[model samples]
Target: DRLKEFPCRIEYLSRLKSASQQREICEALKAGKIDIVIGTHALLRDSVRFKDLGLLIVDEEQKFGVSAKEKLKALSRQVDTLTLTATPIPRTLQFSLMGARDMSIIRTPPPNRYPISTMVSVFDEQLVAHAIREELARGGQVFFVHNEVNKLPQLHAMLLRNLPTVRCAVAHGQMRPSEIEEVMLDFMAGDYDVLLCTSIVESGLDIPNANTIIINNGHRFGLSDLHQLRGRVGRTNRKAYCYIFTPPLDVLTPEARRRVAAIEEFSDLGSGIQISMQDLDIRGAGNLLGAEQSGFIVDLGMETYQKILDDAIRELKYGEFSELYGDELSNEGEWVRAQDCQVETDLDVALPESFVRSATDRIAIYREIDLLQDESALNQFEKSLEDRFGHLPERVKSLLTIPPMRWKAASVGVEKLQLKGGRLSLHFMSPGDSPYYGSQTFAKVQGQLSRYAHACRVRQMEDHLRVDVDGVQTVGEAMTFLDYLSNG
Candidate 1:
């Protein structure tokens, strides 16, 4: 009915339809007579072609097979594409996190929506009966998900025997498409009080009246699957309930226990992102770039991979060197060692327990500090810490000086800077081997070092130059001396 009011023609194509119907739809699409077409993977077939497709929208994108997505990608290159998903697969989420793709998140739930009350417990038939009775008394419906199709009949019979007065129906993927559609429509029209179904209800189904869900063998499903199943309920102002039934905690696998616990903990509205991050932690993020890159990422570790990825993106976007590598160095088109600086100091540079309580949070802060690329980032981090955790302690302030020291070290071509045993050592790569070594800046630095001969000693090793400065006992003194060397 809505299609009649639209300015453009619309067509629907599906594998379930007759061959003549599909052919007519294909012809209409190819002739540009149809401005909009909705269908399944049949649309990706070579026989089906679009004349002037402008936008392609994929819903439940995570449910599509790899080949279908690949085919969609081929089509997407020529048109704008938008993907919608409640729970994104880890690969898609990783791409968005790494800035390879753009993503917009809708955190706001509809008005009058309340957080679903979730509970994980050992399966009890009486408890299930009680929940169903409560929802039924309130004029609502229920979804009882039992994944195994072979056992669904047994479960359905049990439900009927337990609560004979309540109307019940079964729906699963193994059922005929027409049968499934009929059962779903019947449920939608309030013909059934409860629908016994499989994970097929995990996507593209919404029933505002179905405010109670009971999943059998919930521990057998993945975290995202559990989340999606739970999402089927709680669509209206009425309060909803989700019961995740599993075996005893002691009997369940460790992974299953964790999944159940996580689902229970994150029951608030708009917690999908948090749940997805937990999914990534449990399941490793596969290769985002390609298959070959997966091996590199595993070998480099996620932290190092993130640093390299950030560097590559920055270099491509702004033609700048990596944060760790000060600048690119090449000799006659031959790659040389990356011009970088390292700081190795034995100072007690760590967050105090009195300052930040959580060990996990401290480690997170350390990673953030390790990735600081510029003075502005460092300053901002310090300010944030002070704002969140109160005044910066003396040691914390000293720790903030490390990044600038590293930046100063790179400026003077010092590849390695070490402070230990009341002495500071600056290691420089060989002049002949380094592109930055023979520059006028290097000469000026050398001249400046010669002036401080009394306090600093310079030695020419077989492959590099080493400068040692005595009496740098504290981190502050080390910072002061490095500042002098970099500025001089």
Candidate 2:
């Protein structure tokens, strides 16, 4: 329809065509006569050339191989390139999230779209027959996806025998390209009531009338693959159904179970982002920076690796931390390191299972607390906990108090705070070179310590100021003492 308005020459190249035909298309593209050329990875070959290519578009970018994508990227260096995919690869998604590339998401589904009713169950012949019959009665089609091509014929036979009146066809990658295309075209024309096929229908095939999909051994598929296959049925307005037939739950591996569960959990509209994140957790972030960095991530753990990356990014964007700390950052691991506020205590500072029962939710809250860098963030975290989990328990409240205590201690050049053996020890950072040195605040702290000489012992070491708690015995008393020192 769009071609009628423009005076343009277009050529189509594919592996299914003869070499002579492909050569002709290439010649037309090189001569600038072809305004648009559409093909598979064949267009990425060295023989292909364009006279003045102004735009490049790759659909289902996640489906391309790394080498093919690299070649496409090289071609798009100075041209306007647009990549589209329902499920983006982790590396590409990370690039977009990190602001390395512009991204736009389409969350609104087309009119009349409904969430697919997904079911994960063991393979039962009666269940499969019932599902196919129901869709057939509604004048709709069905997609029976079996991953093994060799077993497709047996499954097709079984389906036909179960439903003698239903017309069933088979399609798979092992078949000839012409045969696959014919089977797909027939299915689209409603010639076949059910198309028993392999994963070839995983991409670029949209059948609105085929609203029922039954995947044999669905546990063998990845999360993204399962999601994309389920997507084939839910593209239209009518309600869709997806039956993931697998072995019993106990027989599946832990990772396989997680993948299936994640797919089933995120079946809402615009759940692609959540699905991608779940995929990342199931399949460790694959070579986001490079293959070499993956080893560092595996060795140091993801949380510690992310901390290092965050520090490096901060250093690059906002100069070195030493610039802010007056060379104290460079002296890290020497006298006293910058931003290292150690908290050693014997108090119960864990979230009790009775309060937050779910381990996943507790870990999420712990991560949020670990990320708090200021008082405002701490306040917000407290408010969120209250809103979600009701009034905080005593232990949880104590857990919340620790971050601000560490922040205050760091602000006043206190390197370590130990509250153990019925005594409290405060070790301040090196004098004269510290930010708190030579300031009125330091003098005020000294005077305050002197006033409590009977309750506290203050002594100046070569590199640090040591304060020993002589009167504080309980955690409450120690907290009160530390609060006084912090406030003054």
Candidate 3:
């Protein structure tokens, strides 16, 4: 209505429509008559196509199926796409981190918004009645979500019988759209004190007058669903309350119990992201690339599956996509460096026998040096060595430097460190497409690359960053250069 030129048509795609109605919408879409279409799963049908499609935006993307997502992805490959989701599933988040897709997160909450007060317990009539009376006294409405339609009447009757003066209404997916609209409109107008319904009110209903939500058997709902269901209230500045009633703790399944705990624990203003991750953990992630549905982490196990995936990706980039990736797929070193950061050097990195005298004592000191973890420990070891064997020799000092170099390299994501051939080389982790490239560590390394600009040479090795620097002929020189490059 606000836009002057492009006509927007919001089609009701929830239920099946007549063939003529579908054809009319489809024709309008194909002919570029409709500029915007706010629809449901029906819009993903084969019959729907847009003329001169330039942008695609997907909201609540986690609710869609794998095949539907694939279709959206295909559209995205051709046009600009912006996916919006309050709660993203674990697999989707992982793929974004792996650089399969770009992602942005909005962590800030709305101004003057209050966190919902969530509590969980077994069903108790007295408690429910008290909660309703409290909200009503404040001139606010209440939402009693009993998801089962058949059991809704019994609960409605109980509410009516107990609180005869309180006006109440029920709405669910089974009800006609017009009927649901009438009931919702009446409730919004304050015609009713309570709206008892199913999960239909999870999205798009923004009635600030409703500040309290009571979810019966909330354990049956997934973590994301529970978050959205509880989200029906607390739309305004008024403080909101969420009561989640479930069966006895012993009776509920392990996953159900975990879900309830997570919902109750994370009732903050911006807890949707955490809730989705909890959902993923409670109910394992599905196959990401394939069309398989959720909860496949049980098969082959997550660790083993990830190992296979890493190997396959590395192999593809090295063999099949070698020419396509060019310098980015230079070698398989990226995969190897992901595990350990080692500094290999041609110079002898050990204490001199003349300095230590006893070979037994030298070996003992070597073992102790290997056990050093931090700079503090290294300092203490250096002091002990100095006290035992007069002043420290250059070789001993260089040997001591290697430990901190490894620590610095590991912190900045360097997997393999080499100090041979009078030049030092650092190999970063794989895949080059990983989100780590854009991280602060990578940025810091880039800034220091300009310090030794003349002596340093960089390469794009299999989607990973590799840097080689000359003029570092000694072990001490190598450690100082590494500290400057990684820590600077």
Candidate 4:
């Protein structure tokens, strides 16, 4: 029997046929004939039951409705349920963040990931032709993104006029479902050089040869939507390119500018993912803890909110550890708002809301953050924060580590070192030095040693390049640091 293929001796139940067939399948499952089965919601009718059911797997958890989720959860009492999802929604992320569920983040991007090259510019017919020619030279495909469905035909005609030799197709949601599917298949089969579509191309479409995307009028889409649409390309090892075309400058809204800027800044791999992750984190915080908690994050600021979350998690689960000193637990730092939180201060500085509201500004902000590594820029930054927040948060202080006389004896890969009164601490990220792993590399015995020195600091010294931080401080002054950091 096919049931044997499941490595079991149970009957098979399927509801792909008529209502009567579904009823029979449910009856079979209820009668203890089927041990492992797969079917749609039709099999979830109340009349169905299970005898000695031990495991259940719900594929594509996001596809299920709330009522269906409740019914599925009820099954959890008798069966260990495994809910699977590639891209989970806000509610699911919230459940994972809270203690309601356990999760494992698959942060390892696909193995063949080559950084996506992104460019933002006004619509240039020549650039369009060049981008298409480049992809064609590499024997690759292209995704010409003209998001407005009503103008899709006109856009398709324009593409045909410019890249006349390259076969092209159009796909949009307004078309018949079957037609959309056929066009997508045709694109995949290499029958078309470009697939001009809306955001409908945003998910679950993998075309390895397609490495170039030109999103026309990209200013209209949100940062997350733009990120997802760009993700449709760059599925191969080749360097993918994304051109986000925006409307003219004078006509552009501040919000539109921000969107385009974000697209430009997030043209790289890890960068775009980080933007998406931060968005998810903010949404998750809001959904699980209530909108009031979300507002609190705005009041406290992003880094402060993260500190609070880390503290809350530690207090509830691990309690205050003996190794962590009381004075070391204090918060001392200045706060600059991250993308997740927004605050208004009595200064000319643009608040974090500016970043959250517009993609163009977000990208510009990121680029600016990247430039904060220079010593002169860092000095200028201290002044800027002081000017913006009125006063730097006393709780926030930077950890300045000077290498010992003997660099070799200083231990390998020592990223940070700090001294508080007579106590000294080293901050490094090595599996061999991990306290959690019980592989403490340094054998130094002192009165009070701590590794929390890396809690929040602005910059890290490097041989060739510097790692910049917008704002950071020692954990000891964390709270006071937050008060100043946030208000500043």
Tens digits of per-residue lDDT for model 2 on 1-488? Answer: 34656677766788778889999889888888888887888999999999998999998787786778779988999999999887777667666765678998999888889999999999999999999999999999999999888887789889988999999998988889999889999999999999998898998787889999999899999777898999999888899999998899898888789888988889998787788766655555556656311122334544564556654664443344545655643443322223456788887888999999999999998888877898888888899899998989989988888887776666656778887778888898654345445555566667778788888888878867889986555556766776676566
Q: Candidate 3's residue-wise lDDT over 1-488, tens digit each?
A: 34545455555444456678878888988998877776788888888888988988888877887878888877677799888887777678656746788877787888999999999989999999999999999999999998899999999999988899999999999998789989999999999999999998988788999999999989888787888888889999999999999999999887778888999999988888788767665555567766654564544654455567766786776667767876664443353234436778988778888898898988789878866888999998889888877898878887888888787677777878899888989888767765456566677778898777888898988667889988878766867876786675
**Best-fitting candidate, scored by TM-score:** 1
Alpha-carbon TM-score of each model against the true structure:
0.74, 0.73, 0.68, 0.52
Kindly indicate the candidate among 3 and 4 with the higher TM-score: 3
Highest lDDT: which candidate? 1
Model 3 is weakest, by summed lDDT over 10 consecutive residues, at 331-340
Predicted structure 1, TM vs. truth: 0.74
Model 3 TM = 0.68
Candidate 3 deviation (Cα RMSD): 12.0
lDDT of 2 at 11: 66
Candidate 1: 10-residue stretch with minimal lDDT: 329-338
Ranking by lDDT: 1, 3, 2, 4
Off by over 4 Å in 2: 1-11, 16-18, 96-103, 288-301, 308-349, 357-488
Candidate 4 per-residue lDDT, tens place, 72-172, comes to 87877767878765545446655565557987655567787887888888899889999999989989999988877889888878888888798988888
